[model samples]
Target chain A: MQTVKLPPLFTPPTPDSPVPSVPFATPLPDIHVTLFRNIRNAVDVRNLVIKGDPRVPECVLINAATIVDVFQIQMACTKALLHQQQGIMRTRSLYSEILFNLSPTNNISDAIRQFGISDTTTAVAVVMVGMQAPPEEVRLRLLTLIEGEPIPLSHLPEFTDLPLINRIYKTGNVAADRGQTLALVVGAMALKGHLS
Target chain B: METHEAILIKQGAEARVYKMPFGEGRCAIVKERFKKAYRHPVLDEKLTARRVIQEARCLQRLRRAGVDTPTVYMVDTPNSLIYMEYVDGSSVRDYINSRAPMNDDDERLLAQSIGKSLAVMHDLDIVHGDLTTSNMIVREGSQSLVLIDFGLSMVSSMVEDKAVDLYVLERAMISTHPDTEGMFQCILDTYGKSSKGGKAVRKKLEEVRRRGRKRTAFG
Candidate 1:
């Protein structure tokens, strides 16, 4: 499990300047990423998210193999915060926005299909963002929701499918170096909606 | 409201650049395009939003084409903010100014690399509207030149636009750094050898330079 505290997306309202053009939640929540391998109930977990079960925290379940680096998740979370702040999120929920932000295209269904879990997906990375509940409490709840062994995020690269990720982002001729690949992928994600 | 510290690094006419803490002990640059009070509110919003998207698009487009540019982390169009990789390097403007007598080999290498980068950008039809020594950085260790500040960048296949881009850099170099005529010539030679439409652009550059001189003389 890895926890990252993101900086606020907007400046706080000051006494002299009482209101901002866009109001944001008082404090943004930290992002928690937990990796699970050899999942026994991948289908059940997907169904819970699809069914909008309250037990599921505000989180997105990503296929661990598609994650090139942990920074990718961090970038998506940052974008999701901005989307939520502006109320311009294309998806129904903030959780879905995080998943959609990871995609290189604007199609919500296509993003879910590519990054979401499947019955054969043995490894999954659960990304929880902006939850009022404590991380440990969420982790305990997640253990019940997902029947799998918890692994540290450092082991994520072991499950990373580099070729698949490159194909998805269409990064041609870029060396297989981790930093280089991550840069291109993150660039693609940032430019998704604005790409001509 | 929770307030995190963001140090103001630069303030320009269009935007303000801040250095802020990002994920996992890393620092990223945040460029915010403030609203212009001189323009109508509705027109200002539309213009600022377009510039924000345009800058982000060019940065990504050049990065995909294998040019060394700041990696964009996020773009908040509604708020007119762009979060990008913080380059920990000295700008070419500073690098040149700091060296009293710049080394011949270093200057030649820097010119060659800058030319190559510009060639790649031009081949992709990316016209860096504002090209100057201050906009280019020499990365600390790798010594590769990384372009920054794409607020005025655009996509155009016109030879005239490409020539004008080079002309802007030429005028900037001449005004800012002394005795850089030879270095500028070296850059042009490398660019001619590397870019596909280099010959036409070079010819157009000559015409542009002549026109520039004529305007200055008339003024």
Candidate 2:
């Protein structure tokens, strides 16, 4: 009698936790402007160019830490952060890095396998933003986000404890509106100049 | 290996082409790899893999979208091999040239067909980086046009970039084929009729054409 052998099931490897790399920490140089006629749809992947810094040029997935690093310099994620049927933009000042997003399609390991974006296009730059909060709360929200588990709004301590902190969720493809992205950049820079 | 000796097919810059046996002499092309010293080993592997994946993806997308390209039977990235359907047809260039003293109706029909094909590609926002007549294969009497070579294809949604791609093709045709102006005009006319952003593209193309004319005049 012949015995049957089953094929091995495909298992994706997990992503490496972001280790602090001594990146070439220079300031952003260019202030390229993008004009927009469609103000309503300006946030659509319309006007933004996500350019990664020297350490990670030509990749779209901006690591959360990297986002934090850039955010410290006041750069923000031009592309909308996506969760299942949701688009989020954080105004936090504590912890920053790429979201390491869970896929909308239920292939749990896909995020870890690809580093973040399915197509980590190098032609675009991904910026990170960060801020300060209790380590546990930040970690939990993020873990839930990446794990793609349904951790409700109340589970996030900031959202529950502080009414000032808002967690906004909208269902759509989060894309950059070139005009708005440029406007934000210009506004931030002008504000920074005023502060200086 | 012995199939090439039996069938005598020519090799390419990167891969050797041969008519070979696939499950007891059911016809297939065997593509053998050639080495590149310039690129690093890891990079080379990644590039080959990406190209194979991209071609397969582009073909699938085109096939799904009803655009014509050969079916990819096999892809061995490690070996840099891609076995595709060998189109039993003449190139659009040959077919165009062979028809001596081509009339306006013939030119317009060919151009319209080309435009429609391009419109389909542009609608999906796939930039065919190398759009040339040589890349397009056709039947003997120009019954149909099948676009080949996804070597430089990339997914993009920029209207400006798409315009630039068409503009590049326009320049290429102008340089290669004699009096391609009327043909291109017809192609553009057809393209304008089909594409959603035709008005914007037409405006962009005019600006591009102006720049081209300036370059020519300066040169």
Top of the candidates by lDDT? 1
DockQ for every model, please.
0.46, 0.01
Give candidates' CA RMSD values in order. 3.4, 19.9
Model 2: residues with Cα > 4 Å off, grouped in runs: A1-196, B1-35, B140-142, B212-219
Candidate 1 lDDT over A1-196, as tens digits, reads 5876765564523425643344332346788889999999988888888898998876789999889988888778878877877888899888788889999999999899889988789999998775678768988999999999999989999998989898889877864588888998998999896776
Which candidate's TM-score is highest?
Answer: 1
- Tens digits of per-residue lDDT, candidate 2, B1-219, equal 011121326545654455543222134443445445688978877876666556555654564455666544444444455545556678777767787457888888889988888888888888888788887887544377788777678888877767877888788787778887888888888888988877687788777777762234453
Chain B only, TM-score of each candidate: 0.93, 0.81
> Considering every candidate listed, which one attains the maximal DockQ?
1
Q: Looking at candidate 2, what is the lDDT of residue A32? A: 17
Q: What CAPRI-style quality would you assign to candidate 2?
A: incorrect
* lDDT score for candidate 1 against the true structure: 0.85
Which regions of candidate 1 deviate over 4 angstroms? Answer: A12-27, A54-58, A130-137, B213-219
lDDT of 2 by residue, A90-193 (tens): 32211122232211122324422322332322211222222234435544433322223222222222111111111111111211332222222222221221
> Ten residues in a row with the worst lDDT in model 2 chain A?
A161-170
